[model samples]
Target chain A: MQPLRLGLARGWVTWRSVNTTREGLANTIIWNALPLVFLLIFRNATIPGTDISVGVSLLPGMLAMLVVFSVMGTAYYLAAEREDGTLLRAKAVPRGTAAYVVGLLTVAVLDVAAAVAIVLVPGLFIVPGVPLGDAGMWLGLVGYILLGLMACVPLGVLIGSVVRSPRVIGGLGFFGITGLAAISGLFYPIAVLWDWVQWVVQILPLYWLGLGMRSVFLPAEAAALESGGTWNTPLTIGILAAWAVIGFVLGPVLLRRMARRESGAAVAERRRQALQRV
Target chain B: MATTPAGPAIRVGDLRMNYGRHEVLRGVDLEIRRGEVVALLGPNGAGKTTTIEILEGFRTRSAGEVEVLGEDPEHGDERWRAELGVVLQSWRDHATWRVRELLAHLGAYYAPYATASHPRPHPVDDLIATVGLTASANTRVGALSGGQRRRLDVAIGIVGRPSLLFLDEPTAGFDPHARREFHELVHRLVDDDATTVLLTTHDLAEAEILADRILILAGGRIVADGTADALARQVAGRAEVRWRIGEEKFVRPTDDATAFVRDLLTGPDGAGVVDLEVRRTSLEDTYLEMIRRHEHGDAAAAALEPAVAS
Candidate 1:
């Protein structure tokens, strides 16, 4: 309980610090706005055999991308903080690690929320035919975002713990997420890809997260164009929850193993290596 | 929490650590009493960091019996951890955090562990002043000078008001003025809380000035352990005797400086003796000789030199 409270405070402090900084603000704006630019470019285009604008169809996918972006963000922070000795600092205090995890998760969630808002608020005014009047749509949107974070944050921690270098995580993680997005049908229908690729993407959380977001934002008529010719709400919920469970189960084990190996000498050796690289 | 445990603050017996085939600590043994300031002096790559890490439960030893505050560090819990303070060599962690902000956040973790006799967490403002960072209390850690940053590290270490503190090369990169201030801060801390400290350093003068007892680690073992004066005397009980007779100057190394000086003063040239001086072997010389003999594969000879002279 105490660790949780402290972690929340730590998370708030860190989030505020990052958001208030010019670099942090610039990063948030640029990344979130990139998807918005795509939406605007296709604003006048309509879906094949439908009256809905392409921009409206792409908004849910953009929201899903924001959630997916959090996965890489979480991994980047974990690896960077570990390299910088912040993780070891947490280990020094009583229950500090617990607080650190809570704080990290808090920041990750807040980042997703901020990114989602940046795209969604302006998106609401620009993209037509979003069922904003329906309360259930709003609830479902919030639910999917929360579920997406739960599924992704733990996977990020697992990746961060396994990878020793932040540069590697940042570089590889960006390409990896971009590739996943390509296959997960964030910008187009999965039916257009090969059957095996569709099968592979279905096993991952991003695909389900994007499916859940589409269900909430797209009109019922859009379901006709989805894979299997309908929205599989149960499958989307089940797959995302399963991914969340797998991540929660495996994340801590790897994180603890990585943490157990941390010491002052290790940190020093890493610093020496980092300096040599520079 | 009120009733402090009774016994040595730290006890290690036959502590051995090996990295594959390379043995770092072959067989190390030492004990530190409560409230005693002990310095672990060793050369680079002498397993100083390894030994400290094992004691701090950050590393596992291959073989040893180790107890820190009456519990094996290998299995020490959070309660055990709260009783210990570790001052790490900082490398840009928490840089965005303000001095006061970081201290208060870290200190809050100890709140539940506080006791009537030994309060957990020294006050934030007071701790800032203690480390001479009061003016920079609100300043970002990244903005601090090297010396100021080191002071903040110390402040963070003791913020939890730990009963036992581990300082690993606490003043490594400090300039002279910063070093002096750091030493004074340590003195005040010890005077105020009687906190048992175990610090590792290559600085012999620092060990002499700051430590109640000094342990010289060479060749993976404690080659010498005693007060600075005792260790110096153990190394051959030798001293340099210098004097001037008219235009001639004389210098001689002898095991018995007092007797040699007395005899010289009362001898034939006693009336002419001027600028008389006797200088005992400095800790630096003793440390170098110990390291040299050990490096030459004369461990027995080096280990015996101190006892034989004593």
Candidate 2:
């Protein structure tokens, strides 16, 4: 319980630092710029069978994208921490890693919240009738966002634990998530892709996250644009919950293994390798 | 016997560490009493860092019986770890945190471990003042200068008010003034809190000034162990004695300088004696000679017969 409380404090401190820092705030804005512009440019463009503008339909997908970015952010931070002596410091404290993990998760949640607010605030003006007045709409939005985070953040930590360097997260991690987004129907409809590709994308959490987001914002008829011509709410919840459960199980083990190997010598070796690279 | 229930703060028996086929530490054994400040002095690659890490439970050893705070370090639980303070060589890790904020955050971890007699974490302001970082309390960690940063590292290590502290080259990059300040802070910890300290350094003067006992590690073993003065005496028993009889100077090296001086002063020529001087070997000389001897095939001989401080 004490570890948990301290972890929350750590998270709160880190969140404030990240958001208040000029570079950190600028980085978040710059990352969302491309997607925001993409939606604005295609605002008048309709989604073929529907009268809704492409901009409004893309908002839910952008929310999904926002959550996915948190995963990348968590992984990048972990890699950077490993390179520095931050992780080893955590290892030295009693139950420090447990608190560190909790702190990291807290940071991820707040980060995702900030990302959503950045998009959603401007989104309300550009996109019409976002169902803001409806209680059900708010529930869907909150539920999907929570479930989506639960699904992605742990997997990101798992990847971060295995991968040695931040460069890998940038090169392999960024490209890999972007590729999933491309097929998961975030920017475009999945029906346009090959059936097998759609199946592969659906196996991932991003697709269901995007779908869940669309269920909350898009009108009832928007379900027609989905692959099965329905919300598939049960499957979305099931799959996302399954990912969360699996992540909760595997994430700790992998993180522990990664942390157990961290020592002062290891950090020095990494620092040496980093210097040579430069 | 009214001794403290807690056993020796640290004890190692036949500690050996190997990486692949290369052996780093070979059959090292030592014990440190509570509140004692011991300096592990050795050249680079002498396994000072390795020995400290194994005790901190950060690395696994090939073979050894190591106990810290009365528990085997390899299996020490979280409660056991709460009693240890470790100061590691740090790069820029918490670059964005404010000095006071970071200390407070770390201090929270020890809140639950607090006992009536021993409060777990030191108050943030007091710790900052103790380490001479009170002026930089609000500054971002990244903005701190190198000396200030090292001081912060020390502050963080002691935030928990650990009973046993491990410092591996804590003042590696410190200037002379900062080094002196650091030494003072360590004395304060030992004097006020009764914290046991095991530090490693290449600075012989530091060992001489800070350690109650100094252990010279080489060839994967402790070649010499004792107080700084004892080490010097053990390594080189002879002291140079110089005297002048009626402007004619004479010098001789003798194992017993007192007897030699007494005889000379009382002898027939004693009346003319002047400018008498006896110089014992410095720790610097003793350390070098010990390392030189160990490097010159005497390591195996020393390893077979370990030196335990009496």
Q: Per-prediction DockQ scores?
A: 0.64, 0.56
TM-score of each: 0.94, 0.90
User: What tier of docking accuracy does candidate 2 attain?
Assistant: medium
Winner by TM-score:
1
**Alpha-carbon runs more than 4 Å astray in model 1:** B1-4, B240-253, B257-279, B307-310
Highest-scoring model, lDDT:
1
lDDT by residue (tens digit), candidate 1, B1-310: 4224788999999999999999899889999999999999988988899999999999989998999999898899999999889987655788777888899999999999987977878999999988999899888887899999888888888999888999999999999999999999999999999899999988999999999999988888888999998887675578888999989999998888889988998899899999999987888888988888778877667766654432
- Show model 2 residue runs off by greater than 4 Å: B1-6, B238-280, B293-298, B302-310
Tens-digit lDDT track of model 1 for A28-57? 889887887887788789888889888888
Binned by DockQ into CAPRI classes (incorrect, acceptable, medium, high), candidate 1 is medium
For candidate 2, the lDDT comes to 0.86
RMSD of each: 2.8, 4.4
